[model samples]
Target chain A: MDYVLLIEQLLNGFQLGIILFLMAAGLTLVFGIMDLVNLAHGSLFMIGAFVGGTLTLVTDSLVLGAVLMVPAMFAIGVLVETIALRTLYRRSHLDQVLATFGLILFFNEATRLIWGPEGLAVPLPDFLEGTVALGAGITYPLYRVVIIVIGLLVALGLYLLVARTRFGMLVRAGASNREMAGALGVNIPVLFSLVFGIGAVLAGLAGLIITPITQAAIGMGEDVLILAFVVIVIGGIGSVRGAFVAALLTGIIDTMGRSFLDVVLLLFLPPNAAESAGPALSSMLIYILMAGILFFRPQGLFPPRGATAAP
Target chain B: MKSQLTPAHAVSALLIALCAAVPYLASALDEPFYVIVFARIMIWAIAAISLNLIMGFGGMISFGHAVYLGIGGYAVGILAFHDITSAWIQLPAAIGLCALVALVFGVICLRTRGIYFIMITLALAQMVFFLSVSAERYGSDDGLNILWRSDFGSGIVDLEDGAVMYYTIFAVLMGCLFLQWRMVVSRFGMVLRASQSNETRVQAVGIPTYRYRLAAFVIAGVMCGLAGFLQANLERFVSPDMMNWHRSGELILMTVLGGTATLFGPLVGAVVFLLLSEMLSTITIHWHLLFGPFLILVVLFARGGVMGLLGSRTTRD
Candidate 1:
């Protein structure tokens, strides 16, 4: 009922949406272009968080850590693509799922081995520590506002790269028809690796930005990754625009549902019954939304034009 | 489908016999630990076999198959919480609930194909998982403990005894395998396999492949629910962890590790995967680091899994 609280939750949802977009963008692109299901994409996000977390700890500078995290994730992405995933693009989806599932295990355990099981945190720099006041006595964290700006900037940058550039044209072509793009002398393998690298970098950026808020921990990528999957699935798997819109939609729905479902349920049920059922129903909100979306539009709201649902 | 015994059939029979004999053999050797291990293996085998029905034979790669196992486990746990200990009631409830869940999921999911199908199933399973996690009446994330095993009502079977529980699982597993064998050779099975191999071609021939696939999914879900019932009886506990996405991945691994599309591949894969995990976990905490790469290698080099290594007929036919 309070407008201030409503605005605050909306901002919370927007911030979460921006973070999910970072993760989902890479996932959609890799899945769209390479036709591979990389379960370890979450592992890449975890690795970035760890790298970013560790770099910030040692150097005591957030900007340098941010600068290093992208390249580190990009390098690891290229390495994984060249070593394991390249051989799997032509394999069955089952094979891709299993192999990448294995990578998730390997990455999680490797992180535990290297960093120990204890979660590592990155402190907020001095300048970005304060909160900003909006109208109606509403206040929001400056760091979260920065995340929104950065996420939008990245989204715009990706849109320009994908829509305006020659390479973006090739990516579009590849997503629509891989064999045709390859036949057109696109150097398909390198293009695949580059796309993969970009995807990894994007995931890494999400991890780096959020580590200060969420803490860098082993297996953190997985929870976000599942949400990212929901975003892309509801958005249309191969569409970046879909991922962006779906991410924000999911984030808002999830945030608002969690915070307000109990109050809303109180209107329909007795107080005790509403109290007990609200949390469970709230947790299911996004999935129910996803199911409804899939039921109506099986290919998602914004399926990439000319690309078949499966590929 | 040939009724005559072949080399693969002989090998499968030998494996089943070996499984049935494990408790007896371990008793003679005075190692009760092996009984527990084999019991766990049999439970996992049942779940894996059900997964194979959908994945290998039906060509519907459901990534959330383990949710049935969780649903089954939770059915018994919830019933026991409210003082219903009879196997007749608890088991039926588990299977029925699993069937209903599968029907709902299959209806929505079968509308999509390939990766979309996989993601939708995963999302739906996660939905149930979150629900379980929020259910404060149950133990939620900590899981619930059943005070007593399913009461068979003065029958010769007493699950309180480890051997009885083990044999009960063994009998159910064998029954499932038999059912699977029968289904795979039946007219319906042929339609399911054909649909998996080529959906358009089958549809062009006038078969409603979606219905067959959905039926296969439901059957597999119910079978997995049975496994969940036995698992709760074995451990006396049920948690959302049982149906976590990782567990679903493990089911897929077991099917692939054994060699998909083969009759006993899931059984074989479950044995190898569980045994390897048990052995590796003792060495260090980083066993998954080793196991992960090994899984990748298996996918890369050992494409057909353990049964494929034996080079027998890959499919049930």
Candidate 2:
């Protein structure tokens, strides 16, 4: 129970929470606005990581690579939406799921084809490199601190945009009641596409940031995307505020549980059994949390104000 | 109720006949590969049929149905690990365990409808997958190998023979199809379908839809577990891969490819999907690159799947 280790793990959890929020934000928005379950959202995340990593290698600058990859990822997202997902908007949720699933396969294999099976790693810049010393023998990576700051800034910016802007109002309206929003002369299709694009950009941002920490692998998106799914579902689909809160909660709980569940379990069971069971139980923590949340609050922690019902 | 044979029923009969005859035909041709392939197909067909029962007729899309396969596979593998390789013990253990898992998970999942249900099921499956992966003693990600198949009795049923194994699997598949057919026409299944089409209406009529949906989910789970048991025996191995989300997606794809709400659609879907991939992979490693778009086209154009192409009315009652 060293303080430094605890702090490091806490920071790790916070960093994970931020990354999850980035992924979950777009998912919640697209789901909230378009009412489409895009299983391939993870593909977009993977594309961002790969594209960002590739651009970084080509440009030899992390900032520039991120800059270039954002729009590229945005364009990819819009293309997928326009080509594959647009036709599915009017179809049932099952159809949307199936179609997006197809997109997932296409993207995963396409990545493997183009990038090869080996994962790419993004190098951190000099300034972003190195560790910062906190009190009590604590040291934190500058990259992770930056991620937390960037995530918070994005959260604030998103909040202001959604709360203070007219377009945001329309997004809110559409999410609440698409028919009513359509009746009010909102260009529903364009708005939906824009929301989807914004979501793609957000997901890409998360992916780009994490490339330095994690290898930009072909199938990386799905692992995080599942957590993102759990985040949104627990946060309540279509609610960004809920997503943000739930994402952080999940990230912290999962990380802490993973790191310390064995220690906690040792108190109850034989040392060998606890050692073996801890990891398994810790891995299941968030899902259990999600199930518990759903069992209690099926609509999620934060259902949009007027819409107690899901779209 | 009609005595006249429809295209759907005729297709089902043809499928069953072909499945039953494949082992013998392959034996005649001395192609053990076909026997192996068909055995794998029958395994998947059973799982797909179970998925179709819930997804098509019950209108519950469980994205993690393959978890039952993992459960069943692991049940056999774990039992064999501890030296309990009896078919009677292992088979029922797998089914019972999967059913129990399904019961607990299904109860919670049924609380949510639509996309939430799908996500929850996926999450639950991932939970099982991760737990299995962490179980280092059981081979975890590497999976466990079963040295011997489930022994039914001394010389009563020898699974070591490929022909016997193939026929056993085929018989189980046919028996499942028959049971599924009977279940669909049964009063319980009628109520399940009714609830699927209109939950509110069914509830207004005083039917406990949740119980029926849970029952369907459990039934599907048990059937898939049976598939898993056969799969582990067929491969003589069990791994977390058997329960991966991708496998579950493939099961969904198979059911959809064949046609949902049709009894034999799963069989058709599994055969086409497995055979196509098997054939394609030999030509190139990037078969998924092509297979991916194929799935999209099927969803986009061939909405009802292969059986729908054969003029079966896949629509719900």
Candidate 3:
């Protein structure tokens, strides 16, 4: 095993973790607070990338486009909540799932219609186009490092907003008991919209950030959204901290397993057998972990305190 | 639960008769494609009916129900590829394997309720999907094409003959509906439905609900596998796409759109859904744009489904 390769993959895992955390955070909050399962959350990610990437292309300033992406997604979030999802909060989980799944179909087709089938190119600005060297002769892309920093900063900001502010307390209260919070004069509907907007922003930001690295093709978020679901399920739904922890764990496990499972499998099986099984097993590693976790603790590793599992 | 004839049962009978007439209707209209299209609908209808057993009646919503369809397809596809074309072997293998997988998955998934059950089932199915996609020896993402249809080893049931294949599917659909009707009305199904409404109460009444649910889940899986088996025979093709998350979503849509927990609802829903898709796709490739919003509207307001709109019994939550 080369030490350099190991360190590089670790960084890769970390970077992936940061991205998953961004997506999972919003998902956890929405699921926690609104008690809605928004499968179209991934559609927001796709829309964010498309809308943000387009803005950048038109304005020719990545910073401005990125800044504008926030309010754009937030407004869309609020609009969707008020229109499509508000009635769904009290509906059955199956209804929420079906509605959101419909949203996914609608959004994907809408994107194809508006943006055409081709992915929009969000070219890296000149300054972000280089690699930075760390000590021990290991170097990594500057863009990925920036993503890590931005992700951590946002994570910290979210923590402070959720933990330190009065609104954060209300949000937590809403998660724990919505009826109590409503009786206590919290504007529950407005709060729901606000939290939904925040989730949209986070999901959009995650999408916008990664579009430069991966093509913002139609339905790009569908695959990643499943991974986010895995994060929340393993982390326990309605728990932000759990989402964060689960996201990173999922990211690292997925990345490392994909890169190194074959080598590890070689020790236990013949070369040809190991080669075929490696990819399949690696892709399944996290799900196996999730199944194991669920078998032992169906509520997940860090279920929210005092919140009903179904809600 | 009633023995009297109702509009629901009449509609179901009418639809099945329509399905029986599809081949003749197609040939009379001189359009061979309609036979295949209605056959496709019947296959999905079977899958939808299986899903309804667990979801509509049992209250165990499996978002990954289509995986069995894929597994069934692959069973036949892989067997036919290896020159094991006998329906005797392929049919049993598909049903047995699907039942076993459903049993294991049901054990783990039943530990959770509501959304967790939904997500876990979907995730597990996705696990199988990724495995299939990575199986380079089995044609992976491109899917595998079988050279021979399942050999029933008799002159009477040649699958390569389109009429025979279509009728086989029709018989299977009729069999599934009969089985579903029988199971849901039986003592076991009553226990299952009772548990769905209130598990604790049912348990207090001295009925163990877990085994009933597990049995229903496995039966549903086997039914869906039969759908997959027929589909593979119809197309002579199998791919991971058959079992992906989207297919599962569509199955759920069919069950719900036709009205869940009702006799004939799956058939009605499948007919409407596939017909709509076929009609919409003809107008433009972006039919999902319309179809998607329509689904949302259905979920939002038309929760009763086509059968419900047509005077089926009210569906329970």
Candidate 4:
């Protein structure tokens, strides 16, 4: 019944929504442009968190670490694409899924071997730490507010790039029809590599930014990766606009459900029943939403115009 | 129609014989642990075979197929926790619940194909996983331990006996292989296989492929649930981890490793995968570093899996 708590929860939801968008954006783009289901996208996210966090700590500056992390992840993404994923593009989706899955196991264990089994804690730099007040006694973490702004800026920048640029047109064309795009003289391989690089950068960005709040940890990517998968599934795979909307929807619903589903359920169900069902139901909220959406719109909320009707 | 036997057939026979004789072999070798190890493999093999039914033959790649295992195991575990010891009730409930859930999931998932199908199944199964993880009454993430196995009358069957348990699993494994063999060759199986290659063409021939697919989905679910039931009995415990997405991926890997769409591929794949894991873990704690790339190599070069190597691509398929 407290309004301030509700406002704070909403802000928390917004922050989560932004993070989910960052992860989902890369996944949707890679899926749309290259027709690859990279399960190790999560591994890239994990690597970003580990590498970026380490760099920030070592350099004693967050900006320097993030700035350096982007290209490194981009290179890694491109390297993986050419070495493992490129061959899989022509193969069945099953093959693509399994290969990326292998990549996931490899990355997780490699991180464990290097970082050891213990998770890394990335403390917030002094300047970025504090509470930001938004009038009427409502306060939110300054870092989270920063995440919301940066994520929104990225979303806007992405929208403009896709809408206004010639490269954007190529991306669209490739997504819609790779063969025709290649026939018209687009460097499909180069374009695919570039898109893959971009995806890795986005995943890394999401990973690094969230680390200060969540701390860089091993196997952290799989849970969030599954969330991103749900977002894209609900948003329609390969659609950035869809990813944006669905990510926010998923993030908000999930945070709010986890925070207050028990309270809400208590109004209807008896005490013990509501108490037990609340947390479980809350965790299941987005999936239930996803299932409902699939039941209604099998293609998702924003399926690409021609997302390979073949199969 | 009769067909000539090939080396794949010999391999298949050998595998069944090997599984059947695991107890004697283990005792002869004086490695009692091998009985437990191979029992776990057979249990996983049953689950993988069920996954292959839809994924390989039907071309419906359900990334969340392992959820049925969790559901089945939980059914047994929860009932046993509450003092329900009868196998009759627990077994039927597991099968019926898994079948019903699969039917519901099939209605929604079958609506999509390819990657969409894959993601949706993964997400829905995650839903059930979370549900179990949150069930505080059932020990939640810690899972429940069963002191007693299912009772099938005093003298009719005793699952608690190791040899009896081992033989029971062997019977079930053979039953699954026989059932899968028969199902994939029947008119229904032919229709299902044709649909996998080309659904539009199958429909044009006046067959309702949707119903056939739904039926197959339910059957696969029931089969996997049976595996879960046996697993709970074998391990004497059931945890939410049984249904994790990682386990689902492994099931897919096993099917592909043995050779998708082949009759004995699931069993072959399960044997190799578990054995490899067992062997690798002993050599080093970081077995995944090796195993992961090995999976990649298999997908890249060994596309037909072990059965494919044995010349098992029958013309009938």
The candidate maximizing DockQ is: 1
lDDT agreement of model 1 with the native: 0.92
If the candidates were sorted by their DockQ against the true structure, best first, what order would they fall in?
Answer: 1, 4, 3, 2
Worst 10 residues of 1 chain A by lDDT: A302-311
- lDDT per residue, candidate 3, A166-232, as tens digits? 9999999999888999999999999999999999999999998988888588989988899998999
Query: lDDT score, residue A115, model 2?
Result: 91
All candidates: DockQ: 0.84, 0.77, 0.81, 0.83
Error of 3 at B207 (Å): 1.9
Off by over 4 Å in 4: B314-316
lDDT for each residue of candidate 2 in A1-311, tens digit (9 for 90 to 100)? 47777789988998899999999999999988788888998988898888988999999998999899888888888887888888888887878788888889889999998999998888888989998887677889888999999999999999998989998999999988889999999999888888888888899889889999887898899989999999999998889999999999999999999998999999989999999999999999999999999999988899878763542
lDDT of 1 at A125: 98
The chain A TM-scores for the candidates, taken one by one, are: 0.98, 0.97, 0.98, 0.98
Task: State the displacement of the C-alpha of residue A108, model 4, in Å, after optimal TM-score superposition.
Answer: 0.6
Tens digit of per-residue lDDT, candidate 3, span B157-248: 99999999999999999999999888888888888888999999999988889999999999999999999999999998999999999999
Query: Model-by-model lDDT, in order?
Result: 0.92, 0.90, 0.91, 0.92
Span of ten consecutive residues with least summed lDDT in model 2 chain A: A302-311
TM-score of each: 0.98, 0.98, 0.98, 0.98
Which ten contiguous residues of candidate 4 chain B have the minimum total lDDT? B308-317
Model 4 sits at an interface RMSD, in angstroms, of: 1.1
